[model samples]
Target chain A: DAGITQSPRYKITETGRQVTLMCHQTWSHSYMFWYRQDLGHGLRLIYYSAAADITDKGEVPDGYVVSRSKTENFPLTLESATRSQTSVYFCASSATGTNTEAFFGQGTRLTVV
Target chain B: GESVGLHLPTLSVQEGDNSIINCAYSNSASDYFIWYKQESGKGPQFIIDIRSNMDKRQGQRVTVLLNKTVKHLSLQIAATQPGDSAVYFCAPRQAGFQKLVFGTGTRLLVSP
Candidate 1:
């Protein structure tokens, strides 16, 4: 009952449609991250937030937007979904920067048709 | 030379046997590393971690070995069980950043 959780564990949308994936953590971790997993690429960070209102782009942030309005919530949005955006999205939270354990949510599988 | 990779993409071992998964990293500046286990349709869970200052770290039935000399890292599971079947990824923590670069991942299949 006290862990990270992602909304709509699965999503399906058509191309050019907007989609938002929600991530929530109960631990109130300061560091929250969004990553996309595709075949051949283990996990690519899309965006991360150090704290409320503080966000930064990761390796592959194009076509994606993220906001951290609260310490427990970080949401990722795809302005316009594309087939390439179809992948498993993972949300993780850490207490600090280095030498900290990251807790992950169940993940959301998005499909863009 | 700051990439993390694995020698094998998949490994199959009989249940109750030991399993060794290998990983190689190129960043000498990376001081921390972690091993994550991800089951199908789920997010990766942290299994174990090790820092550059140490060569080995153990947790429960898992052990992580870090060889900074060759930029290699390994995870060994003793008496592997069916529950251990999952995709294991090795991630090396960047020196001055919170971002972790993950390896391709090794799929471990345990046979009963």
Candidate 2:
């Protein structure tokens, strides 16, 4: 496929364990982002990368870590998963413009037990 | 993760009727706002966007209105259809920034 993709459309992990969610885009977009959707709170940005090797924190990035070593790949890791960390994670990519619309992948539903 | 139903604010409308969804933000630095539609089990798709400098922007069947004074934005759909039923979200971004922050979504249900 030519669009963005997310691994393990669904995942279940134990609390305090470590898990990493993978994101890949074929467009080689310059901007990639990770967001979590929960009840009452819409899609909140966890981390975003402007380009390769450049990442920044968003509104909620306390327990999440992101890395972007390659333009086509951006992975998010949960150092110590907690119950509160359970949510639907979405990965998106956009071209090199500030006004460019982002393209999102089918979310990964992560459940922490 | 497990998601509960009926938690989001919903707007129920009959087919052929006009629908309007509203969103509010408190960030004064937000320079651009966009409306997105998300179907079940799918990611959001952009509908329309309006910048802080503009008051209203119109698309094919959707219109976005931005009110910088009160920090309010709205998305209006003309002639609602069953296919238009989905969760609608408003995202705001600061100037010179690509990071978008979304607001709580409103689920639009169109009855045929």
Best-fitting candidate, scored by DockQ: 1
Q: What would the per-residue lDDT of candidate 1 be over residues A1-113, giving only the tens digit for each residue?
A: 79999998999999999999999999989999999999999998999998999999998999999998899999999999999999999999998866987888999999999
Model 2, A1-113: lDDT tens digits are: 89999987999999999999999999989999999999888898899999999999987899999999999999999999999999999999988865777889999999999
lDDT, candidates in the order shown: 0.93, 0.88
Interface RMSD of each: 1.1, 1.1
Worst 10 residues of 1 chain B by lDDT: B94-103
Residue B63 miss distance in model 2 (angstroms): 1.1
Residue-by-residue lDDT tens digits, candidate 1, B1-112? 4688899999999999999999999888999999999999889999999989999999888999998899999999999999999999999987777878888899999999
lDDT of 1 at B99: 78
Per-model fnat list: 0.69, 0.74
Q: Which pairs clash inside model 2? A: none
Best candidate per lDDT, number? 1
Q: How does residue A58 of candidate 1 score in lDDT?
A: 90
Give lDDT tens digits, candidate 2, residues B30-111: 7877788999999999888887889999999898888789778888999999999999988887778887777779999999
